[model samples]
Target: MSKLLNWFKQLDENLVKILLIGFIFFVPLWPKLPLKMVDYTYIAVRFDDIYLAILAFIFLIQLLRKKVLLNKKFILPFFVFLVAIFASFLWNAYITKLIRLPHLGLLHSLRRVEYMIMFFIASSVIKTKKDFFQVISYFFISVLIVILYSLGQKFLNFPAVQTMNPEYAKGYILYLTPDARISATFGGHYDLAIYLVLAIPMILSFYFAKVRSFYLYLFIGALLILLYTSSRSSFIAYFVATVAFLLFTRKFKFLIFVLILTAGLMFTTGEITKRFLKTFQVRRILIDDRTGAVYIGQTITTKELPAGSFYVKLKDQSKGDNLDTFRNQVVLERTREATISGEISTLVEEKKYMASLSANLRPVNTVVSDISLATRLQVEWPRAIDAFKKNPLLGTGPSSLTEATDGDYFRWLGELGLLGTIAFLNILFLILKTIWVGVNKLSFSEKLIGYGFIFGFFALFINASYIDAFEASKVAYTFWTLAGLYIGYYGLKYEKA
Candidate 1:
């Protein structure tokens, strides 16, 4: 161990950067710290967070010694963004009752510092062609292992590394089951899926740059795993990114081939094809007649009125709760009881009629309805808008609300207000602006990478309007690191004098 320490001490700054990048790329599966707490099983300081903090510290030492350079172009916007976040956090904590708890808002605001550390390290350290290729290649390899693990979970009943509080995480349980959406090594299915969205384009960039058969194999495996995850938003984001890549790089034939291949996969690939086809199904209307039913894991306040159920009547003292609440409660109670009695009789004759249709069409134990979109519209999005309206300048504050923002735009806007929102957008704009500086200076391979990052970031940005992709730890880490690599690849021209 002393000898190892001596060797480590002897190594120079370049080696430290290389090793940290490798760790960032290769170690998604290493954060399996076996600890659990009430309402939360995940550790407060996860392994990835530790690795990133170390990377940032090493970069700091290099800067102090004048051994490395920082990207000066981004410094203004980056720090401004952090200031906005902290300002909003402070306001919500002290003045407004938006976040209620000051500590929670402060905690959320501080997470930005951790995320930006990666951006700085990546943009500054990985500044050469050799470094860019090596780091991204390692990342591809790491995700390939992720794909294999997902397949194992799907085929072999592999147990998941539990990170969520089991009592509160039905989604985590669903992901672990056979025929379920696989999260692979990541903490959540959305995290895994969006990480693939950011990565699949870049891996394909390698293939287009050199026609490497190894990259081709990796791409195929990654695509298969992405499909198996069955995340509709991920699928959409990846498709758009892939299209942008093909158009920007002028790989029209290859693009056609991939499209055909994906179409073929949709039919030939068992669960994926079914999921893809399910996207087009009419979900608003159900054949059965029930006021409430279980869909996915939530109780659905379904709308196809049972014959005599719709009545514009005053609240009765004898009847408990409001109509909507009462309906949902009944649905939740029945769903819980349905876990025991599978063949419970319905209160309505139309429900019995629809029961046959549901048995044939819907998955077992789930009613034939989709409330995800409705929930976003009625609950999450409206709540964010309400918060934004109340405090348009700085909104509420950091994590003022629960994880219900569903949309990142609203999360940032509603939580941090205009000041935070503008800062956040500026950070992304400057990064992309730096990458955009070189139109003709980049080589074909470099152009492919630049295009891949641009398109990938675009997809994720759009995806954020649906889910809080920007705030998610793994996705945020990957985004900033990729942004750093792209900046290193083509953004060096915009470097400080």
Candidate 2:
């Protein structure tokens, strides 16, 4: 027993650092497969959760034994944020009873902490510059694995396990259809796309700094995967972030090369371009005033309109006469199949419904949006705004907005309210501020990599406008981990300088 205790005591911070290195590969490359199901939510307790929980427990024990020291720089803000989360959860779950399931609400609140704990774990474990670079090399390898897996999914009929729906969350393996977006090891295409957006800039920075062919190949592969994901928001984020990083680093010639390469890849797929163009279009729709039934017409893709375009509702001039004129204006004959059941027999008839609906049909020209944006505008965003209106200070609570608001700002406002949002934003602000200050003291190559992190962060912020990228488990974990590593390295570099 004494020998075992001595051996345990000998286990040092290096063990934790090694695990953190493994984390860089584990979090992104591992598929989200459900190990246990959490009640009242589709979010299952996956292997990564179990892994992190164990890691956190070990870290805590180490801290207790004086084997490691905690970074206190973020404690205050993080504490306040935790307080806000619990306060909101308590208020909503018990007092007001806005949150129906108390356990789920608490779990939702704790999940935020779970997502962020890696930041401190990462920051505390970096003892030297070697540690930083070694972990980063592992990260590059992980990206390569992710890219290869994505290619496998695209060409080699690789199976995917996704959590986009409750059915998919049950750990079922799915084969993607030919036209389906590739998620690789991620829960969804959006998560994978955002991950690529965050990673590509950093890869480019390293390639430029070291002039390495391997990083260059990784960059190209990552871009191809990004195209395959076909997430418009991520595409936009990638373009903006890549451009900002290149221009800020004054890589003008390389900027042109990146632009040309990206353009060629984008055009080669044309999936993203087609989706962007299809976001809004002018269409003719016929409304039956009597039955309140709407019949949508063919899309006028040639006359593509900007989002929120005005509709032309033609005034019924001599209502009956106009209806007759519209019916006559229909060039093609349309038929509807109706099953008529008599006392003894059932008869199927094809009716000329277009001519018969002359009295009630009203034609109008309106702008129609694609399913994705329409759902957000019509349902998700409005629901979040309603929650915010209910409680401006604390909103409803975590899990109050259901699975997602599809927008991080709205999710924060709806779930955490103003106080929680501000506190969380403060944590981000401090991290960025620290990076900004400490990065300047580093060598030129290190400085570029640091700036790459900043731009990647900016890209995520842009992505957050339309996607809950930060809320995504894989993306969130990877992000906080990277933030911690960068800050830890920056602190060491600053001290050395």
Candidate 3:
């Protein structure tokens, strides 16, 4: 027992720092392979979970031994946020019974803590700027590997293990189709795209600060990967964040160069551009009043872009007929049923329909939205609103709305209500405040990096408006890890000054 205690006492902070460096590479590079499947959700307990658990255990021991000191910079907000999460869980699970499964709700609540705790662990290990830069160097190396693997997936037919669906979550290796977006080591393309949105700004900042060609090359590679991911929200977030970073850093001369490169890449990879154009279109739709049948006049070839249905009564059917229309579209029709001696009879009839419909039918021009945006607007967004309305304070609790809300704000509002949302936002507010104050104290290169991280966070906020970015494991974990390092480094500099 004494020997064991002595050995633990000898365990130093360097070991923890080394493990942190390893994690810098592991979280992004390692594929998400499920170790155990959980009920109610497809989100499985993976290798990363086990690794994080072990890391946390070791970190706890070091804290107990006084080898590492905790940073209490963002402690108050985190505590309040956690209280809100547990309060919501307890309210829904025991009081309201909105949470059908107590265990699932508890796990969902715990997962948030698991992701956030890394901030403290990362901060505890960074005692100096050297430690900060060393970890960042490993991070860039990991990014390079991720970019290379994405390229391999695009051209070399690399296999991927994705959790986009329940079946895929079972850990089957999938070879993506030629036109499929590259997810790299992430769960999906959106995850990959958001991750790049966070990293690209920092890469560019480093290049601009040091004028290093390697950093420039890395930026171009990451941008290419971002384009390949083909995530519209992340793409928009990337541009907004990059522009903000450059403007804040006063790198105005490089704006034209950045624009030319992005435009050229967008032109070369026209898939995303085409998707944007196809988001909304005016189309002719025929509706039958008698049978309540809807017929879309246009045919969609690619499954990637599906149109949303919207109907508006045409003031004049003649106006719809005047527009270019489908002359004769073949459709299945049902014949009237007749009863003879208590036996029902029916017939299937094939008919040709046109924009000029019968008196029982109405033809109108309706606007159709793409499936991606349509899902959020029609189903996911409304569902969240309904959940929020049910309990304006505590919400319907976590996991009540199934796997995704598509938007983080809606998810927070629907699951945790205003209290949870406000607390989490406070945490962000505190972090941003710390960054704003400490960034000026940093050296030239460090200051540029700080600016990059600040804008990267801004980009994520834009992404969260459309995507549940903070909910995703890879992106969320990376964000918190980098954020911790940034805060830790800032604290070190502030104390020194």
Candidate 4:
């Protein structure tokens, strides 16, 4: 027994750290029993139970050994960021009237604590290159399983395990498509796709870890699953990530390979290319028929507009009158303007006029819809900002984004105020700045892996413009884990380097 204990003691700390990384990633899978919390949106598996059980096991074993706690130089930025979060939480508890207080969104404050624990484990536990590679290997393996499951759902029509289970949805990635999305085995296709995008870089990180050529097959397989998903957003994100990765790593050979692939796609996808080119010809080409359909679609023929609607109504005095009078008025007005401008020759043609109007209006409708969704953030953000302007020291409160502003920035401002925003931004800049510093120190293989992590991060930031990615659980987890790995690598090795 002493010999066995000695054997365990002689094992490197880096290996244990790597195991801890695996434990954290795979912990989500262990919480099979779902408990629906009052404040949370869905049934959450009790991760706290699993975490406590693991911690107990670790603590019992550590009774026989000494533990080393590595002090990270970058800890200040992380602490500052956390302080800002608490400050914001407190501020919101005070200012917001309609919202509940005392327990004032304390659930989320606890969730932030959960995140901090994960970050602490990652930053402190991981201490060597061996640990980094081991963590990366597990990431690749975990994602490979996810990829296979998603592909099976997409192609083999694999049945969901929980049949007639209302709480559970179908497939690995459920709700894959309007017809059928490629979910593999995830709860939703979008989630699966997003997860895959995040994993690709981590897998590539193993390139310098002395992995076998078969790992390349795994990478290609993951890419295939992503393609099967046919998620346009994911596709765009992947392409952008690849380009950024190549550029940042200065992988000229890979860049040339991409150029060749682009050329091949242009050559092979003739029909698709034709359709792509046709979009640019929208102005030049107009089918002679469908003028009536085009006109009706273009003209705003009003029925009873919804109350408090943003829609503008003019000449709505007579209920008896159809939209025909307005249509005629529009036509007459256009004809008169054309006559005055000496475009009467062109006005003689009905086809040209209708086409122009329809083309113009189609874009307007699209723009209007886009703006309406975007305006939710725009409107809520200013209010949050105004709140910050009122009290710039302490923030509004925790989860103030949902209460005070629909936006990430404004929510930070409203909850934490200006002081908090600066602190939060400092944390963000610190992470990026550290990554920049690390990238310079890496070899070709390390740089390749780092490129994926960096590019994935860059993609997330771009996506943040459209969606509050940092606010979502899945996206936030992915972002922080990568950030943790990057920081952990540098923190543990800062002295050695």
TM-score of each: 0.78, 0.87, 0.90, 0.66
Tell me which residue pairs clash in candidate 3.
none
Worst 10 residues of 1 by lDDT: 303-312
lDDT of 4 at 64: 38
Best-to-worst order by TM-score is: 3, 2, 1, 4
Q: Which stretches in model 1 have alpha-carbon errors above 4 Å? A: 1-10, 31-43, 162-175, 272-369, 493-497
The lDDT of each candidate is: 0.68, 0.84, 0.83, 0.53
Cα lDDT of model 1 by residue, 411-441, tens digit? 8878888988999898888877777675346
TM-score: which is higher, 1 or 3? 3
Q: At residue 164, what lDDT does model 1 achieve?
A: 42
Candidate 2 clash pair list: none
Candidate 3 per-residue C-alpha lDDT over 351-446 given as tens digits, one digit per residue, 9 for 90 to 100: 222222344555676766776787898799999999999998889998888888899999999999999999999988888788777878767877
What is the descending lDDT order? 2, 3, 1, 4
lDDT of 4 by residue, 1-497 (tens): 99988777665444446446655455423212344433433324354445544753463354235453533565687677677666556556655532355354566665555554455455555557876666756766667666666666656676432211335522122333223545543334444556666666555555434466756567667666665554445555666776677676576785676557644644453332332332221111112132422222132322111111112223333343244444555556665677678676663465577456434432111111122233543466666776677677765566544532334665666666677678867877787777667766766666566666777776665544434445544445556666777778764444455
lDDT score of model 4?
A: 0.53
Top model number, TM-score: 3
RMSD (Å) of each candidate, 1 decimal: 8.8, 5.4, 4.2, 11.4
Identify the runs in model 3 with alpha carbons over 4 angstroms from their true place: 1-11, 288-294, 298-304, 310-345, 348-361
In terms of lDDT, the best-performing candidate is 2
